[model samples]
Target: MSLFTEAFMTALLVGAIAAGIPLLLAGLGEQLSEKAGVLNIGIEGMMLSGAYFGFLIAWKTDSALLGFLGGIGGGMIVAALMALLCVRLGLNQIVIGIALTLGAEGATALLHHVQFSQSYPRLSAPMVFSIPGLSQIPVLGTAFFSREPIVYLSLALVGVFAYLYRRTYWGIALQAAGDKPAALDSAGVNVMLIRSGAVLLTGGLVGLGGAFMAIVGAGIFVPFMTSGQGFIGIVLAMLARGQPIWVLGGAILFGACLSLTTALQVAGVDIPTDVIQMLPFAAVMLVLVFLGRKANLPSALGAAYVRGAR
Candidate 1:
């Protein structure tokens, strides 16, 4: 029998959704932070920290749900440090962000070595939540309807965000906080608080993405297991250009392209391994480069906000 089949395509599609979830969550978080005018380069660190803590907790307790919480906590811990340095003390954003990523990488590796070097631990298969009627629809059923609960939640979040952005005071505050902090400050909204909250929330979402990876995507933890999904997420956020719906679409597209690339390699396409690996990255970049030229990020992005400064 030939390698190509409906089942093979279905498996690839399934893998794509699994890979895309992390990117979508992280991208959404990044977009939120950007909307509040904080360029969050520490997202990679946040994700890595989540993966480590989530994996560790899950391994110890055998509860993926708790592992998710642990991951969120880990991300929040990093976010707090970020807030203290950049938002509170007004440190340089890029410098602090890089430091955070490097710190998390080293710290997580050390912890992993100490705890699981001798005997690597892995989680058992996760329990998935399948939609009843929708799940019975052949190819579409398993690919889109039958999935982990988080997958459905993540998809639903796009609509929720859309509603928030279009019809809520908090969303407007987030937009104002990003576009004109001084204006927001004059309007009696606390600029620093908004930025801090955005960062912390970003950390939580990104961390959840990482935890999902370890608990569901990989089922194991390794040093730097996040690879570059966090960064890819940043790209997706930028490409989405302040639209949550676009973020969702971009993430799934990237994931699908990545899946297709992997399928090509598996089917014995004559591409180099390194080049094949580059498919997802290149595809996302190329598409976004053209479409995102008109993308207007916040003017105040990456700048530390100081009250009453000229």
Candidate 2:
């Protein structure tokens, strides 16, 4: 390969990893929530809210860590609203999530304009910590070790959830709650608590994704900065059918598409930026169609699990 082509390839790989982190994080969290039988369509809203709050906190405190944590808190707050609507009030999950997204967007837009004046500069982000000798490897090292600490966090979360869902008692219990809340309720698992916990955890991780975008990825807060990454994440969750490993695979593919677009643009390719921007969404539509009915979503998805429901 030409030196230019090699450089482009390397850049593409790096960019894909960076772009994939947000989706991977969001997907992993949503996977947990969905495994507990809750469909959180509010990921976009939570991410946006987190983005705004994270940027503001990071900018004001001059602490990237604070900002990142603030983002997680913001997502948790939005998830709390989702919990109130879907879990507490027994509202339609789809409507509740869509509405929350709209509300979050509006709120963040206002906050960005009023509080930050829409120009929150990027705080100095935390550095990626390599895994000692592992960081010295070749292409593999760059792929895994050269990323930000949160990148590792995102990957670790996948493993954590995978083990939690597939091997552990809590994982089995959560999945049982999702599949049949009555069974769990009868088993004294406190279905509501488990589901609510999952939702809160989902929000926190999604918020972290947003914070990464603002502090590490974008380095500045812009209106709608999340740019539908949250939505893509939801689609990824659906595609993976709540499997962490599958979700990571899907995220990497989507991230590759996103990275390709970015790399092409930076390389001054002839393609229109608009078309490149649409690749992620287009890929989503294609993947959704490809999965079709084969995607075995949770039986109780989008339903409020009440005790003793047959």
Top candidate, metric lDDT: 1
In model 2, the runs with Cα more than 4 Å from the true position are 1-4, 131-133, 136-140, 265-268, 278-293
Model 1 ranges off by over 4 Å: 1-4, 261-272, 288-292
Q: Write down the worst ten-residue block by lDDT for model 1.
A: 264-273
True-structure lDDT of candidate 2: 0.83
Clashes of 1: 0
Question: How well is each residue in 62-84 modelled by candidate 2, as lDDT tens digits?
Answer: 88888889999999999999988
TM-score of each: 0.94, 0.91
The candidate that achieves the highest TM-score relative to the unseen native structure:
1
